[model samples]
Target chain A: MTNEIARPLFATALRLTRNRDDAEDLVQEALYRGFRSLSTFRKGSRFRAWMFRILHNVFINRVRRQQLAPRATDPADLAPSDHDHPIPDLRDIRELPEVADRHFDERVKAAVDSLPDAFRVPMVLFSLGALSYQEIADALEIPIGTVMSRLHRARRHLRTELADYAREHGLAPDPHAPEGAGS
Target chain B: MKCVEFRAQLFPYLDGELDEAATGTAAAHVADCADCAGRTAFERALEKRLQTALLADVGALDSVALVAAARRSPPLDSPTPASAVSSGVSSSSTGTSSSTRTGRPGHVLRFLTARRLLAVAAALLIAVQAAWFFCIPPFECSYLQAVERTVDAEGTPLRPGVVGPPLAERIEVTPEVLGYRLEGEATVVDLGLGETANSAVRARYAQNGEVVHVVWSDMGGAEPSFRRKREFDGRSWWVATENGHNLVAWMCPVTESLCTLVSELPEERLLDVADKLRAAER
Candidate 1:
């Protein structure tokens, strides 16, 4: 069962650290701690959520001990907008010709990596489909509303980052409109 | 639903987190409004692309390496401080101490003053006394001596009783058969019988407030001196009591190992356990 979790756990770690060696170290430490505390795991509970929670805690603790800069994005800034607006122009990415190109993947990764830890964590957990909004909230010790707001802003940031790529590929309708205009 | 309501529910609707009513209303709004339909399609495509990018090259991690690292890690429940764990991991990985990582002094100098030396002497004296009081095993002259050491007997006074004969049917003695669950892993204990120091496999079982210990060992031709003996099903069992504890010893027919069961249970229950304990492969 843990074998199945390795890939997604590594993927999440990589997204968080943005460095291969750090990601590997983070995963190894989390898995070690998880195995040692296996006795505390309650039966019939979601193992994915449990493991993800450990990984999240380990990453956060490491960041704190290193005294890295605090989260770049503020929670208030990530709040969902009250007014209605048109969505950003994002064409069906798979239908685009660049979808088959390796550059497309790199572009998406770079855009995701650009997000601050505050927004990036929820985005990675949600995009992995390993957790729900409630599970993300529980893992990050944030409210569900905060989870939703960060996810919304994370995607908004990614759309802005990739707007040039979308326009270059003719995926967007307006060529002259500024990127992230609707957002 | 209006465009405002559809926008509010858009992320949840796409994530399959919306209730039926909200999902249905969002779907209706998207169907009527071309712009809402495009936005929904764009969001779905964006999520799909994000998942693909995030999961790409996840096969790079070595599962075997990860498991090995985990196996090498110390138990989190140990008496070690939590900071020590992080420090240990860092030192193992980077060849550095906690002081190096945190830029703080890791050790302090201490002078053994007269008061400190006296305190150390007092601590050593107390430790020696505690060990003599608790670590010494009870002495028994008979073959029960070996059994006592196997059970780590504290010389509890056994009660005097005559246990009845075993039944004709012989079954293996297992936690399942005795309706008890094994508490933990079975441990190999040294019997310290003679020069050779024979070892026995001891397994403990508990149910509710009662606990039973079963020990299996090769007695090396030692015979029980207990007066009470019973024969049934082509085997004989020696039953004896020391202080308050009851013990039943018999040669297992299947494994040919001397199986001894010790508990504070009544004589009848001990015999019944002996009966059920025989005849199966060990």
Candidate 2:
């Protein structure tokens, strides 16, 4: 059970931290905290979601502490603010082409890693296919609508980022080129 | 559905979270409208690519080590004062002070009272007994013991129960009972000593380097308790992992006995085998 649960936690941690060492540390701390609070877990509930919630909280706390520790001398830095990123409407997601089935592994990773945390968390959790939208909402303590919105926006960002790759493979038409340019 | 409605439901539709009515409507819209279909295909492809990239190369973790570390760490509800002490120690180690502080003993000499000494001795005795009980060989639990016996004696001829008819005749399990050919015969496990030995039959199965042991016991109401309850193929099975082996226990409706399937396979595969056994029973 621990091994089965650890794999997803580790994957999510790796995505969040973007460093193997930090991911391991983050997972280790979350697991420790999870065990200590294991008594609070209700039976017959989704155990993976419960663990993900703990991992989410641990990661958020660690980020906040790291952000605060270096700027301890400034009182204004202690205020909490929503970590929302302004996403520009670059291209109609419908106009974007299908990503080639092969050899875009690194680019996809970079695209996902580059998303802001607010959008990235839901996208990563959704892509895992381990949790439903409701479960993701519960894990992150957000409304289900928010989860869907963030996921849609995140995909839009990814499509914009990968659109260039799609054009290079001739899978999508180049928007900047004039009509009949390729012919 | 209009394009606006389809767009609103696109993500949910792709995720399979939409209700049946909404799903049908979305499907119809995508089927008829080339633009919506293209967008749906694009989203599906992107999601697949993202899933593939994110899950790839997530190296294996040493679960045993992680579990050990979790056990060693302090509880979540530890007192705040403990943090102060820990921080002090950390600061001292990193600071420029090489000198260590030693506590001075109190002027008053207090010795352990007779009652306290006796209590200490009693605690030590109990600890020793526990250590001996767990550390002693052959102290394996009955379920694990049956697993070990079946795996160790693979390909051996079937053995009869000491006091009953042949073990194979007592249980209806066969090599192909689980929809596949297992490689071993059934053996009766003595649940007690001598004439009172309540017997249970265990059959071993191996395929593609995966081993499974199916044990049927008539020990009424002796079903092993597991925290996770899973419903597969319209029957409930109790699932648990013990000593790195997966165990699925369910009551066989046909034999009217508790049946346990044990294996080193992943839980999903083990559950598949259990479902097959259930189907055979019916």
Candidate 3:
């Protein structure tokens, strides 16, 4: 029973947190919560969706807590350091063909990570979880149309990101290629 | 259909959810229109790459500890918040109910204490029962214990007898060490996305010399609980009767494989053949 969610839960958490240790912790915490709340789950309900919902809820709560926490700041923290003059941007590095080739996957992953949860959650669930739009809507408690629209928007964003990467490598048609339109 | 319409339907058509006529029409349009063809190809390539990147990055999952953690906890429903029950009771009672509602915080504290006691009791009960189940040795564990149930047979011929058509042009097997022989091309079956195991590989060889059903996946596959007995190579294999049909499933940690061999042959022969097939590659 628990085995069915072990890898997927971890993988989903990993994607959400982008850290292996954090992912494992998130998965374990969600599993414990899901186990406790098992009775609340309707019979014949999708266990995957339920488990994922718990996982997503836990993730969102953690994010909220982190956001609400007050950070202790020293006066020096407000001051800019000479060593922090400027970090080279990945977009700048991506202009080189070999750099783009080596970094495209990372760039795509970073792009995915950068998406706001509204678009990221549904997109990841569809692509990685193999969930249908209805299932995604159920899991996220959103309207089916919202799920579809978010997926469309998310895919478009991913394509644009990949297209930019391709352009960097001279693999795309044009740098100014029109962003394809969809619902 | 216009190229715009065709492009709009590309996702559904690629997903194979389009009506047959629409699919045919879309295919015809793509055949004639280079732009649509390019877009469709790009979408397909993107999906493929996304899948590859996702799976490749899943990394290692420690399943045993996860299963143990799940097995330890009792269902959380018994400890419903006192406020909920009291609120329901108050709703049915008189004006004095308002006073009772005011006491909810205290009621909740008491309830929490009681719930803690109940949880401890339940945990103790669970431990005793779990020990008994394990002592018996042939308990029906959850279906998840049987993971990774298919072979990656891309370009590999499944049927030993049939020479013409092959099973699958693309094979994605989990655990990566499963093998089987099919009796005929007709034995190959379509695997729907819903039916396949998560992050696992599965294929049905409806016919070989004898029918061989194999499913190989990681521990992250879902199914209902069934009678199962653990077995060889530090994994659990179940040979149980489901709906009056004999089903044999194996989860081998040694080789990271889960295989199910189904046959009309007697149990002894079936086990023998399974053993041979399991040991074939290793």
Q: Give lDDT tens digits, candidate 2, residues B35-78.
A: 77876776666566567667665645666545443333223343
Cα lDDT of model 3 by residue, A68-150, tens digit = 32134423224344223211112222233332243666776777777766777787776665555777788777777667666
* Model 1 C-alpha lDDT per residue in residues A70-156, reported as the tens digit of each score: 565575564557233334445533355344567778888888887778888898887763577888999987889888878877776
Sort all candidates by TM-score, best to worst: 1, 2, 3
Candidate with better TM-score, 1 vs 3:
1
Q: When superposed on Cα atoms, how far off is each prediction in RMSD?
A: 20.5, 14.5, 17.0
Predicted structure 3: lDDT: 0.47
> Where does model 1 sit among the CAPRI classes?
incorrect
> Per-residue CA lDDT of candidate 2, range A23-115, in tens?
655676675555445445553354556677888777776566444222333332232321342222223333433344345666777787887
Winner by DockQ between candidate 2 and candidate 1: 2
For each of the candidates, give the backbone clash count: 7, 0, 14
TM-score each candidate.
0.51, 0.49, 0.47
Query: What TM-score is obtained for chain B in each of the predicted models?
Result: 0.30, 0.31, 0.30
In model 2 chain B, the worst 10-residue window by lDDT is B89-98
Clashing pairs in 2: none
The fnat of each candidate, in order, is: 0.22, 0.22, 0.10
Instruction: Give the TM-score comparing model 1 with the true structure, all chains together.
Output: 0.51
